[model samples]
Target chain A: MTGIVVLAVAVMAALGFGLYRRTRDGRFAADAAAGDGPTTPTTPTTPAWTAILAAHPDGELGERATLVQFSSAFCAPCRATRVVLGGIAEREAGVVHLEVDAEKHLALVRALDVRRTPTTLILDAAGRELGRAAGAPRRDQVLAALPA
Target chain B: MTGIDPRGPRFTAAVTALIVAAALVIPSANLSALLMFIQGAFFAVGAYAGVQYTPTAVLFRRVIRPRLSPPTELEDPRPPQFAQGIGLVFAVVSVTGYAIGPVLLGQVAAGLAFAAALLNAVFGFCLGCELYLRGLRLKERLA
Candidate 1:
């Protein structure tokens, strides 16, 4: 029956998501294990931030700093990200705010390892890696990341 | 005889018909692929149209149309504007996917969307309904 097939696909997708989350979580833990505490891990292999920078014509890091957000129109978190990041961008005149539609840019998404909506990559004024957050960042975190 | 709400039943029947069609046609016919492609297109438009007419139908059916209001709570529960917004997004995604992607892949996305729509129609189990609700909740929390 159609219902049965649909149910099978749902089950498979859930399984796949679970496996991916586990693998990604393990990878994070391993990287953290190798790194010193409280230090921002920056590397060329972590090119997600780089691709994000390239998305904006002005580049990732501008005079103030930049918050590049990958978003989709249908994605709910994206709307929330817009609200949260919009406030941040408003307060910081130098911060370059940009958003890319994930659905439209599938290649960029896979290259950047962006699996979720509202993924934000933060960079310094010079475009160097600062950090990134998956969901909406706390106001304090955003403030802390800003350049003096 | 036990009474059943009309809109709910109608939605359910539509969903059932689509699913049955998909099941029967998939793997057996090429035209079935078109089903997947247009599934989201028609569903999003159809659902919007269905919801829009719900209230007016309720008014007419109970008052002028001579069907008495049932005791159950299955009347049109959605706000017209909200339903329309959701439908709009659904329709946009469906149309864009069909436009840009390979015909088969686009149809796959559409097929999946159609299946979800059917689930919502038949069982009142809307897939993205709660996502919007949660988005609103997040907005409220932030505010």
Candidate 2:
């Protein structure tokens, strides 16, 4: 029956999306994790910041960690991200949250391969690009991702 | 740009799911056509004027939300509006598909819309919202 088919689709979609929903929110993964290369954590003295910023221009570097968040006006997650990052910046003295308008910085977005609103590019004080999280990150997740 | 109750859209999706499911399961061409029109009209109103104006939203405000405990958080309206736009496209295409030739086209479109709404209703997943973001990414990549 068509109804049976439709209901079956509903059940499958529910299961598929339920699993995706469980994992997709606020989870951070390193860029190198995409490849076979083991993720080597950025050191305090890395010289990669200048080159990274030259390639992907946005905001000034922070003192400790710079959270460069690419946000679109209409996206909902961006709002939540703004709050999360702002709170992090507030509580932590050296950290900074830089919110970029993705609409205005299409070239930068393309350059960074920012595929979603609220895609955060975590940079060290030296301006080196670190890992990125594609959704609105939770407080603990953001805190954990920051440079020690 | 106020935040919606979040549950409001879910309620709307639930209603949409039922209507679309009924339309799909029933074999009457005339009945299906009528159902599509009604559903399409709801989508159009929600798409253009925002979901706050829809009949379902009224139900949420007047009856449902009161019985329920207050939401711990509120969500932006734009993503859901984007979803309504996606719903509008499918509903229109389904109507047009039925008008032209193959009834199956209409059924498939309706089924897709129904499935998407059902996903949001039950699982709190926003497929349309996700697609909108992906489409933006694709456009950025292409340019």
Candidate 3:
């Protein structure tokens, strides 16, 4: 009897959690640490956009906005995210997609409080973080989250 | 990096969720222990050897993948492998709990594992993978 109850509760809890995650997954939101709004300035020691470009010589920042994606080798959703961000970058003028290997950029990952892979940071031309999404974001969500 | 059919881990999670649920629900403690032990061995292989080497992945490749349409994309195997390690830890605790006098300990451990597996199987959410990344973040914070 106890086992049955436990199993039922487990199933229900898992279902609830899954549903909640589904709604939130890939939905870009303002960084929690930024507090109140998105106007927060980059930290004093925050690496410059130029530094990021220097690290990845092949990458280029967009004239208007840059999509910085932090991904790792182990994350499955990171692949889907890459495609989505890459497509957006291709379609939108003055927008560029930059992929950063999370494993290789430990300092940046920590500095940014990047909690997970497939984290996409939307940066303005000034290199200020506009927003971030922790999971693989949908194309529509990415579009909606972009600054007009 | 070697890519795998992302469905492989989901398939494995489904099987694991079922087996672990059965182990938790069945009336017989001995049977529960046996089921958990079997699942543990599967996790052991997946964690240490690689996610692709698991029996469930083999089954998926041979029996299941053939029937289904090709996966649109493949994923890195490291996250699932890390998840397997987490599962193995719970399996060990659950098995030991069943073997020892305090059976409740076993039930809780198995229950947590079942929750994680079900989440992955049904929603494709990887709790263990999330934990792995969180662990990295935590390590960085402390350092």
Candidate 4:
């Protein structure tokens, strides 16, 4: 009787957690303090956009939008995210996809407050952080997150 | 880095979930301890020797891979390997709990491991991988 109860509870908890993650994962959420939000006027002396571009000499900002992905060596979702973001960048005009190795860029990763692998930041042409997603985002979700 | 068929780890997780579930459902403590011990050995081998050497990986390579078409993509093995280490930790606690006293400790440990394995098997959600990444982030923040 005890064993069955434990098994049932474990199954329920796993299912619930999986369902919750599925609903939220890869869905971009706009930053409340970003864009035109009223927040503290104390902007960082070193902006994240400049720091990111400075770190990657080869990376150029897109005319319309940029998708910046932070990936580690061992993350499986990172591989899938690369494919999705790459395909979108290829198909869309003036959209750039840039990948950063989180392991190598610990300083930048800390600066950006990236908590996990395959985190993508959607930046407008001016390099402002419009929003960010914490997992492997779907292609349609990425499209929807972009500014018109 | 050498890439592996991503399905290999998932297959391993499925087997692990079944074994853990069995361990949970079995009424006898001795049998449950033995089952967890076996699973822990597998985890140890996978974690230390590399994921490719695990028994289920062997099964996947010899029996499963040949039957299915080639995978569209391959994945890094490090994350799944780390997951094995995490599984080994829980399995150790579970076996100790069942083999000694306090069967509840064993049950809870095994249950958590089972849930993690099920998540990986069913949803492809790698809890160990997430933990590993989070650890790195925490380390970076501290540094």
| DockQ (Cα-based) for each candidate | 0.06, 0.49, 0.63, 0.64
Recovered share of real interface contacts in candidate 1? 0.00
- The candidate 1 chain B region of ten consecutive residues with least summed lDDT is B72-81
lDDT, candidate 4, residue B52?
94
lDDT, candidate 4, residue B46? 96
Winner by TM-score between candidate 3 and candidate 1: 3
Write model 4 residue lDDT over B65-126, tens digit each, in one string. 99999998898899899899999999999999999969999999999999999999999999
What is the C-alpha lDDT profile of model 3 across A1-148, one tens digit per residue? 6777878899999999999988878877776544334445445334346556655778776887889998886687888999999999999988889999877877777768788888898876766677788889999988877766
lDDT (Cα) of model 4? 0.88
Which candidate do you rate higher for lDDT, 1 or 3?
Answer: 3
Better of 2 and 3 by TM-score: 3
Candidate 2 residues lying further than 4 Å off, grouped into runs, are A33-58, B137-143
Query: Which sections of candidate 4 miss by over 4 Å?
Result: A36-47, A54-58, B140-143
For DockQ, candidate 1 versus 3, the one ahead is: 3
Q: What is each predicted model's overall lDDT from 0 to 1? A: 0.49, 0.77, 0.85, 0.88
Best by TM-score: 4
* TM-scores for the candidates: 0.41, 0.85, 0.89, 0.90
User: What is the two-chain DockQ of model 3?
Assistant: 0.63
Give the per-residue Cα lDDT of candidate 1 at A133: 61
Q: For candidate 3, give the lDDT of residue B21.
A: 93
Off by over 4 Å in 3: A32-59
lDDT of 2 at A3: 46
